[model samples]
Target: MLKKYKDDQEFYSLVGIKPQTFYKMLEILKIAESKQKYYGGRKNKIVIEGRLLMTL
Candidate 1:
């Protein structure tokens, strides 16, 4: 299983893609539902911005 990346930079480093590309892939993955999406932090369930990414 793929580990949950901490942030976009880490994800980019692991996946070797640019930030815009990462967002594009994320949108596709969300549509496919093959990956899980989560909002960061303990409260305020907002779609985690700046650090948005995914895991397998």
Candidate 2:
């Protein structure tokens, strides 16, 4: 299992990505949600926004 990361910087460190690269990755991956598509991909929640979310 991976440790939960609270901030973008920490997440960047864990994933070994540069700031620019991380933003690019987020865009390309389509996991970081927009308001409209949030419900459509409910099961695909990620820790991108500092929420202590987990799947039950």
Candidate 3:
């Protein structure tokens, strides 16, 4: 679904943020996720980018 948006304007219109900003936010999430210890629970099946998009 992410790959479907090729134009910058279209992507921004759908997501309400610049693609660069999205990637930056994703990087931050990845770092934060990496530092966290695993707890006993169902793990997320969705990729980080999808989760961020859902939040947006």
Candidate 4:
């Protein structure tokens, strides 16, 4: 299930979730361990990256 892209915004757009909710879901998935670098930005992009990783 490896994603074909590197942008998280694309992923969230495909999944239809708000950026905040997507971050929460990633936290619940236990994959937000290194989140400091991802704070304060278009989080949809970050979420997409996480989603791609999850798929992998």
Candidate 5:
């Protein structure tokens, strides 16, 4: 769903953030996700992009 918006204006309208900001936040989230310690439980159903979009 996040990939549906490519134009900056459209992406901003949909997510209330500029594409650059969104990508930056996505990168940060990916880094944090990678650094987390595994607890050996059920995995997340949503991808990082989806989670980020949902949080917006």
Candidate 6:
């Protein structure tokens, strides 16, 4: 089964990650976006839509 998350809170609930860690991961993904100039890989990408995070 797969689910799409609408916020950090929803993602946390679905993945069972702690609030602190969830926010940290979101922060890291945001930072990595700026550093991804030549990098291209499906696994390394962060998929956030509006407040939604897509996962499979």
RMSD of each: 9.9, 7.8, 2.1, 10.6, 2.0, 6.9
lDDT per residue, candidate 4, 1-56, as tens digits? Answer: 23453576876677676556755666666545346445654435455455645564
Sort all candidates by TM-score, best to worst: 3, 5, 6, 1, 2, 4
Model 4 alpha-carbon drift over 4 Å, by segment = 1-14, 31-56
TM per candidate comes to 0.35, 0.33, 0.80, 0.32, 0.80, 0.42
| lDDT score of residue 41 within candidate 5 | 54
Error of 4 at 30 (Å): 0.7
| C-alpha local distance difference test of each model | 0.56, 0.52, 0.84, 0.56, 0.82, 0.56
Model 3 — TM-score against the truth? 0.80
Clashing pairs in 3: none
lDDT over C-alpha atoms for residue 40 of model 5: 48
RMSD of candidate 5 to the truth, in angstroms, is 2.0
46: Cα error in model 1, Å: 17
lDDT of 1 by residue, 1-56 (tens): 23677887987786678667866766765564433325333442444332354342
Report the candidate with higher TM-score, 1 versus 2: 1
On residues 10-48, what C-alpha lDDT tens digit does candidate 5 reach at each position? 888888999899889999998888677354456679988
Report the lDDT of model 5 for residue 9: 97
Worst 10 residues of 5 by lDDT: 34-43
How much does candidate 4 score in TM-score? 0.32
Model number with the top lDDT = 3
Candidate 4 clashing pairs, residues 3+ apart or interchain: 8-48, 8-49
Per-residue lDDT tens digits of candidate 6, residues 1-56? 22445776876676677556756667876676657734764543434422324431
Per-residue lDDT for 11 in model 3? 90
Measured with C-alpha atoms, the lDDT of residue 25 in candidate 4 is 64
